[model samples]
Target: MTTRELTTDVLIVGAGLGGVAAALAAADRGAQVILTEEYEWIGGQLTSQAVPPDEHPWVEEFGITARYRALRDGIRDVYRRRYPLIDDARRIDALNPGAGWVSKLCSEPRIAVGVLEEMLAPHRSTGRIRFLARRRPVAATAEGDRVTSVTLSSEIGEDDVTVRAGYVLDATETGELLPLAGIEYVTGFESRAETGEPSAPEVAQPANIQALSICFAVEHVDGGHTIAKPADYDFWREYMPSAWQGERMLSWTAPNPRTLELSTREFGPNPGDDALAVDADQSRNAGDSNLWIFRRIAARDLFESGFYQSDICLVNWPSIDYFLAPVLDEPRDVELEHYAAARQLSQSMLYWMQTEAPRPDGGTGFPGLRLRPDIMGSDDGLAQAPYHRESRRIRALTTITENDVSYEIRGDAGATRYDDSVGVGMYRIDLHPSTGGDTYIDVASTPFEIPLGALIPQRVTNLLAANKNIGTTHITNGCYRLHPVEWNIGEAAGHLAALCVAEGTTPHEVHADAARLAAYQAELDATGVERHWPEGRVYAY
Candidate 1:
């Protein structure tokens, strides 16, 4: 066995949105950064997990990081330059490539990769940033409360690499570095008594983490070929839960997040409607009734007639959400089992759709739905990573609780304002079915601030949290775990690390000293990070 070693000013152990943002932020500040990812892709949720940006309505005008907006514009530019879009579609100011109702910018994961790669190209070539894909962190070297380095092994049989850095950011999906570094963290739901969240369970449910889905992409075809039956097809075919209102997990009958009532979603080839006509404001309407174009990544109608033959759609619906077991904090074998079962659940879903799904004409199945592994950069058709909704969050200097952002708690008063806000984000408290057999716990939430204190771990002097693993409680995590928010969090973490490195201080010192905190906030402001919302508040996105 051979060992490799590398050193950098900052180390980010995840190539997700946060990791990418963090790397860029640190590199921009002249700090050498090393970013690693378990998958071949760089963008986590945006590229690897295949989930589109779940953003606020005002995203186009304001209330997001400049880099994030750049990413959005880059994706739109990709469509304009590469795809032969309709004149009207191409000219629209806020042209949604896929025009999927789920997001204002529903695009293919591959396009995101291209844009991200271009963003990091300069830094990569100049040696300001070194990105290694298919590297998984296996261990961490901790000196007392600080993480000195991380030991990672190649996922593709390369030599083990040990990376030493002044600052280590846990940007990995699910906060994989927390436990490895012996960082104090919390998992699953914190009891209402602990977090004072209105919707929290009476008792702590360690195994009650939100479900993760193996998102995949598919395109409609005219052929009748269907995917091979999944090994666990029978298990999922008849699967029923006491908390669910549906007969089976595969049907259109699923519990509504807001009302918890049985609801049915219609699936079809295309609505034959204008993409501009589809209003994507989930606050006004969930916009989930139409499944085919809900999160469609490639809309053939928007392009020239012969340009595209099929409308590619990402399958990340409720039917395939796997919550039978919690993947984190479990035995290694158990975690593997949960992941395997989750993939099978998605496969079973496709099989069910192909063989037995009820069509509008009362047809049995639509075997023409062809899986597109190329879209997701996966040979097995599954997403590079599961769509994780929750993570092991650090016990930070400031923990965002349900009371801070909950509309039920704050009402017309709006979410609590933070003086040390580093960025801003908006989304509903949308918790999917969990391992504890709980149904969706979606609730309205006001636009919230991302406090810099949330990124600073309480005990770890040098380690920082840059992803969904920040100091957000289970209930609050629902709203904070979106694409833009995670990016903002990572960006903030990166800037914070750069500041600390430049000042010869720790994250704790920055938070503790009023002067340093103000300076840090000023840096964030200068970096085009939106730290607050507009005066007039209107929640629709």
Candidate 2:
């Protein structure tokens, strides 16, 4: 019954990469910004989700927009400032100058939180920008084609704050706002007839999307004692995923045989050692050391000191991704149950490592697998939130299908010519399978642009979705659902909202006028936001 109201030019929901990008872009454009996050901290995947950067090998060279590229650079800057390596004795700046495979900022969630806070410091100082943390949208007021105001509930205190903004951007992981705002959305897969996505199943149903992950930290005990058994050990031990029928958890003792076969098929190197050795020749990472072992391995130096006081490596590998979907078919508390099952699987993997995993000459693993909760900024002994891989997509002006972007589907894909293009994203269509009985739906893709029409609602003029909620089919959603691309989408929405406010033009109008839309694209590009891939050579990693 308690409610208060505030006003802003732009309201950004979810403080993940997309939301952060929107915040930065809007604030930079001199818009009154109100950024809200359900979690206490910001930096969606990089900070709170505890997942390492799944960067393309050409990250440094090209393919991503300037803002996303800046984020990658910012991560590198953090590591360069933090570490004082022995390599500095020879080369001053060579003190852990990142890798070509991924950027240098390989630390815990807190590091990115700190980085995001620093990035927003200037905006926070200006007083025009405000961040409402631990808050989520409950309802939205729509008048004609515009959203008048949105009501949000704060977990910090039991109060509802109605934020009246010119525009509302939904950057949530599950696209939570689409349903709350009564926006029409599509869930689950689309049939081949619907999207003609070669990998698309025959019938599209509300089955599992991708499995949610409860990423945990771990450190080798060396000669220490054994780790404890997980509470739900029974359920995970009996797990046989639909997409994969291998053992519930692959580890030092057990490897996914299909992975080896896939590696051989691709002509990649074989580096499936029982333990990852920090050898001097660390440059030889082109092999499958990253592929086989890393999903479950967390580095010793990946977190801040005293954060966990243990060398906490996170467990989010291929083995423990629970194949249940939380947004669809609850099946009697699926989120809670699936999370528990995932934790048990990871913990059991740790246990097996200590009790039965192979040693140098085929002995058991070292005990004392330690975990770090400080990295995630919660005492729950797990990630702050589930590593959500997919979400409900809105039915917008243009629905990008697999044929439009997927490399497997579209050979030598060209950036679709759109007069309404507002943003750009380029990552492989990487869909980690779920309980729906699928495989790793990983498809290579070319750089693609986002159309402004895709963000506009047919019925709602005042409302625009910025996150995975936009009109992308499930097949194309695989590429659009990543950390950086989400940022570009949300940032474009923020720009569109500000334009709507200043020029009094709706998103549809902006797209309708070629001259005005061209001006908008020019403005975005002037501000370092690339709407399409510039001339660059594409390389295979």
Candidate 3:
């Protein structure tokens, strides 16, 4: 237990998008900030998880914060500056990548991470920001009521660091720090009787939550240069289900709101770097071969040209998820075991693609499906972390429940009338497959406000939640779990911490002080964070 000590105005645990946003926001407001992450990578879902961001279509014009919008634009700038756009793509453009709901502008995950680092450069140079990568919080020191310091430990090093700050933000993937800090946190799910959430399990079982995905990239190389098979290829080959396509091999599935069942399609493309014209209608019209392929590979041709090979494939079919029931309660070597399982998941998806996917001529498995390790890099051609849709939510002053904000119950939205709005989030109600049951739970959502109370924990005087783990119910979590919304929560938390340090006021006081809270809302608004939806189509989500 070798321990060292340090001090800062604010300390943040976890360097995911939310934590990163918090660090940047607080530091920019002249607060010294120290942030820690378990992984070497910074961007959580956007980078490490290989999740081509789950951004709303209108984000470029009006969805999230100015900071978030800047980050989004930065990703595009990277592509424009580094890659090449084809003549047609460049010429007739309203070029949104993936032709899907998620990322409007898609690029390699690394690009997003690089841009995030650049955004924090000025603050780092000024000593306002310090990144303690590969470290986890060991303990949280509190005095009377306020958090005084936090001890962080790194597995590789002998020395541990203690961070003292006015405010502490918990952005750990699983609310890892909340427990260490003695914060009141909730795990798994609450029973339907408890929260009255239709989606909540009939019985309360917190551990049975959504499973994580370990995604990878691929390329359809011409000729016979298919990549070598993954190490645990057999386990993946045997993974098949009645609900999936082609023996549960490479398949495309999206949550259909009308049917509540996943509509899956078999996807395969020949000669990796090919281009298909996709329109706003979500229609692909590159003629026969494209209609034949219609697969959502990283069609590099969709990007601005000069990007060397507009030909990398992204493997995110629903086939490879590390299902929850099987490994949710693995008591032995959980992290390592999960990693092993996750890798097997990615390899399994690839195996399914390579050796089991359904081809156009009704063939099973396109052995030509190659894993481009160099593209996604070292963490076994997959992301360094798993795609986490839900996590340990804190028991806060106000637990945002489905009754307060679910599309199924609201018909519109439950939390549409938030007066203490710090930010707003709007997305289709999208509950991913959970161990409780396989339910998409997709429904229309009214643009809703995020109450500041949801971000503040009930017990921790100085600690706050800055990720999807914010005080949302299991049901409401579906709408608030996307990338931009998490960034909004984090940015607001950062600004809140800065305000607390400056005014010597606790989050509770600020909430109580309508005058001061209004001022804070003003600041957030001036920073281009929408506390309320505008008076038009924007409001009509």
TM-score, one value per model: 0.98, 0.86, 0.89
Q: What is the lDDT of residue 309 in candidate 2?
A: 34
CA lDDT of each candidate?
0.90, 0.66, 0.71
For residues 414-491, what per-residue lDDT tens digits would candidate 3 score against the true structure? 445677888887776666566655545555566677899899887677888999889987777878888889999999
Candidate 2 — what's its lDDT?
0.66
Q: lDDT per residue, candidate 2, 471-535, as tens digits?
A: 88877888787766787787888777777778877777877788888988888888767666666
Write down the lDDT that model 3 would get. 0.71
Give the count of colliding residue pairs in each prediction: 1, 8, 14
lDDT of 3 at 5: 84
Q: How does residue 406 of candidate 3 score in lDDT?
A: 54
Whole-model lDDT, model 1? 0.90
* Native-to-model Cα distance after best TM-score fit, residue 80 in candidate 1, in Å: 0.6
Residue 493 of model 1, lDDT score: 93
Give the Å shift of residue 258 in candidate 3. 5.3
- With candidate 2 superimposed using the best TM-score fit, by how many Å does residue 373's alpha carbon deviate from the native? 1.5
Candidates ranked by TM-score: 1, 3, 2
